[model samples]
Target: MPDWATFAGFAGVVLVLLLLLAHASKSAVSGGTPIRGGVDRPQPGSVDPAVAEVHASLTNRVRATGRGTDPTHATQPQLSTLALLANVAVSQGAFGLLLLAGGWFTEIPPSAFGVTAPVLSASTLGVGVVLGGVLYAANEVGASVGERLGIGADEGLREALAPDSPAGWAVLLFLVLPIIAGFEELLFRGVLIGVFAAGFGVSPWLLAVGSSLAFALGHGAQGPAGVVVTGVLGFVLAAAFVLTGSLFVVVVAHYLVNALEFVVHEGMDVDWG
Candidate 1:
């Protein structure tokens, strides 16, 4: 029942606020430097041998622990993959919940909400079961496949899916993530699509495709392949929104996907790598 304009306005405000808050938090944390005084400080003219030794010891310890080092040089690829997966789960979970609530209250369905829903739930699942399985099988067929070769595919699938968190983190999730998610869906899927479709006097499909592509491009940090995958997924989600003319379904589907991913990952020891 909610029009695209309404959704867009709401989403835009929330997105701006979330970005601002995140930036502020980051700045606050990064603004200060740790101070080690007294014993660590050297006297004028002469360096204290004890202080130098202590400093060297501390430096060595930090290096050994892999802290205070360049991430590119020091990071373990497998562990990095796992961490990325975890982060994806968290972000998607937060975003999906926000969309769900917004859609529910606004009386929108999946068709209106955007591609984030059906793509992740129905379409992506089917694709994964088919294409993902094929890829995995091919890897097993002795093609010099390494561990976590399925990581890229799995990561793509998981991004479409949503995630859950411990109950303890629920409050924080509700406060921050939902608002941001709601805003993004409203702006990108709802308003952008609506305006473009109207202005160009084009079919909904065209508008959806255009908007989704734009959405994918916004994630340039993810690289070309990732962008292509996301763009395709975006188109699917947009189609769902158009078909149903509602955001509610999209939101619910998004939430379910994320929640399921979290539950699965938490319960299973499937090596992310």
Candidate 2:
């Protein structure tokens, strides 16, 4: 059996960190900056091409609706892509360290976290790619349905996170998204559900619901509708993890979903909402 006391300590730290992140997200959206209405607008007088492009896109969206972009958010500052990347890298790196430390202290093997070597195959990767593509399509369909129903999502969050330069895009796609996907899956799926179940003998499906709620809450920056959408997505990912028992698969699929969202929505300007 694993060390219950140590596991409790690890869980406590993780919970605190998750709550902090969620609060920060809420603060980012709920502060003087309105949620950009439908899409993120550029900072006033910004010359960055990416910002310019986003502004143009936002303008077009507003024009299509025969309305103007929200003046409240017109002057709201856009987050620097590099700064956002650095912040995510540092936070996720800390999470990785905590995972390692917890494993060391509790004597939990990596397998308990779903890190297995045997599953690292081309076929496994292919499976992830397929799953990711399908999930992305499903998400688009859901978003379209939600839009038709007048249930709006916060596309501004994604727009603001989109990169401004080729180099920034590369970093976001190759490094940032993968780290986000990996750490999230490891914490939400592998540890919260998988390890806890193995260590405490609780039902993983129940844990899935609990962890999925946490996962959804962690994305509070995405707004209320986003929270609902994320909760459903989290559960689907959790189900995949529970069934496949492969962190690799879920990470890859998660990465693809995020990467495609950024690429298609922001980069390609194919707005589903």
Candidate 2, superposed: residue stretches over 4 Å from native: 31-79
Cα RMSD, each candidate: 14.3, 7.6
Against the correct fold, how does model 1 do in TM-score?
A: 0.43
What are the per-residue Cα lDDT tens digits for candidate 1 across 112-220? 4343444555654443344323333342332123223532322322221122334423532343234333444555566556443543356878778777766665433
lDDT per model vs. reference: 0.41, 0.68
Each candidate's number of clashing pairs is 20, 0
Over 1-273, each residue of candidate 2 has an lDDT whose tens digit, in order, gives 568568757866886776675554455334323334534332222111122223334444445554344655433333345555655666676776787688778888677777788858896798789888988888788778876886645455466557778977987777767777877888888888888888878998999999889887776655566667778888988888888888888888888888888899889998755
Give me the overall lDDT of model 2. 0.68
Report the CA-based lDDT of candidate 1 relative to the real structure. 0.41
Error of 1 at 62 (Å): 13
Clashes of 2: 0
